[model samples]
Target: TVQALLRESDNYIPQVEKIKYEVGNGTFVDDGGIYIRWINDIVRYGMYASKTFQRRDILGVYSGLVTRQLTDLEYAWEFNYLVDVKDEEDKKIRVCIDAKHMGNYMRFANHRDTNQNGDQLYVVYNDLWHVLYIAQAEIKLHEQIFVNYGQGYWENKKKYDF
Candidate 1:
């Protein structure tokens, strides 16, 4: 199956960005890093890119525990995605990925209002179970990456404690 594996890895690239963090009142003196911080329970997470990314560049991929879905309802997890997979019996099964236990650097990125600039990245290949965070704009050095959580997510959720 070497050929098959190589075919899949070809679909992805060497991850271009690294996920980093800072603490309260700490000066962001470090160079070539991305940072995430929490203030009074509000996530002020930001990504400081060490390299620039062109539009449509794959930022990162989301991978985690895949389990059977309990209908179309969103699964309870900080970062996750839903997709369908075929069972051994050739039947379709809706799956909910619990990314809380496993994910890449993009998991640390913040969520922005869709109308703002959340579209910077998006989830792709839902059915294939490989969710990618693609850059929607020309990202410059020292910029943060954000993705739209969508109205469906906002309508039923409170993102943080303010």
Candidate 2:
């Protein structure tokens, strides 16, 4: 049975916990809920759902400890993973996540429909001072999650074929 989450209005804020740990080579949130695999040669790391989540649900929170605060956006995109958000000092910041060696389940989310999964995951820089991943649509069990890859990723891509 589904449990109803009550809120005063659509803007109701829920308490979200931050869990930071290794994703691929370990378990997190649940007992190893997410896994990485591929049938053959693929684009790269793929994050699959081990559990189902309702639409507008809080899927996961990006709680990686290691972050980079770049003075400019030019060198920030050089890293493989990154998110632009406001830090504790109330300043615009870009978080460069090095998921190649260390990361969590949230890193598996694709950008610019790179995984051909559309936009299943959404990046929300919450007012509670954290970046959380919300479900863009109803996420079924065992399905792959995706987030809107920033504009820079779509500049060269032709059409929304992916």
Candidate 3:
């Protein structure tokens, strides 16, 4: 009975192959054509592509639970996950995708100066902005996926003088 239950759960698992043609969330995909790998002593883990991706291919959505801005300085680096968006009144405000505890594979993407992929923030009908990572160039298999976390991210960490 336990094995049968597990087999049924597989049906709900996200798969990249079943993704829609549009550039939205990738079937809530995780562990698709990507994997988490050890980097080095400095950079702990990084996400790498397991298959070649053409330019502008939708990788997956940076899916997470949305919440208001977090002011905890201890976890300031997580601020990179926060996105600025306009509210219903058209006033700009910061919204955070609290992905630390719950999120898809996109959270493992590291920062790169010349990243092969870039993220596009899209606002759905719910007015929540979702971060969508797309291939900036033709990326071969095994290449690391990186996105520019923006200048503000580094500026917040004065020690990261780059």
Candidate 4:
């Protein structure tokens, strides 16, 4: 069905007509070698040349991702941790992160720890999602935390003396 439609469309016009138009307009040569002369003209001069000009907004909206705003601290924490999950290729999973969404996750008790005078603390939890296993773990910010995923220790916090 699609093949038939494509054949009938202007883009898939008969080869004979296409060749004639090309030849007559000097788009094609007959020196034992066919050279496209009107290629630039065809691309530059046209009312219905591209689909983008016809449906730019629809294309933009379709390409955009739908996101929900977060209003709770707990939800924010979960969202933050989940957002850290990245592909092995280091690509971000979320298409976009809004301020509200970030704020929700910022409410985590350990999101950014500070002292009485707002001095940054030495202890911090940096959780990351493993792409292959889809598991989350917390690693100490300034310390090395060994994770034993095979042993089912996802969030086991052990101090590394070394």
Top TM-score model: 3
Question: CA lDDT of each candidate?
Answer: 0.49, 0.50, 0.60, 0.24
Report the C-alpha lDDT of model 2 over 55-161, residue by residue, as the tens digit: 66666655444466434332123222333466689787555634444446676666554433334222322432344567666777788777765778556654433
Q: Clashes in each model (backbone N, CA, C under 3 Å)?
A: 0, 1, 0, 2
Q: Across residues 1-162, which tens digit of lDDT does each residue of candidate 4 receive? A: 434533333232233344447867988643221111222432221111112112111101001112334342122112232235355798755422233343211111121121211111111112211111101232222221111222122245432321
TM, every model: 0.55, 0.53, 0.64, 0.13
- Candidate 4 clash pair list: 76-104, 76-105
Least accurate stretch of 10 residues (summed lDDT) in model 1?
A: 14-23
* Global CA lDDT computed for model 2: 0.50
Residue-level lDDT tens digits of model 1 in 1-162? 434644544454333222112323464243433445443345644544556878766555554566664332332233233323567997876555555555445556666765222242222332243456666777777676777655666676667623
**In candidate 2, residue 132 scores what lDDT?**
54
- Give the lDDT of residue 85 in candidate 1: 52
Q: What digit string (tens of lDDT, one per residue) describes model 3 on residues 56-132?
A: 67677676667665544222223223334566998876667666666777877877766447454332323333456
Top candidate (lDDT): 3
* Candidate order (TM-score): 3, 1, 2, 4
TM-score of 3: 0.64
lDDT for position 63 in model 4: 10
Runs with alpha carbons beyond 4 Å of true place in candidate 2: 1-14, 17-33, 69-98, 113-128, 154-162
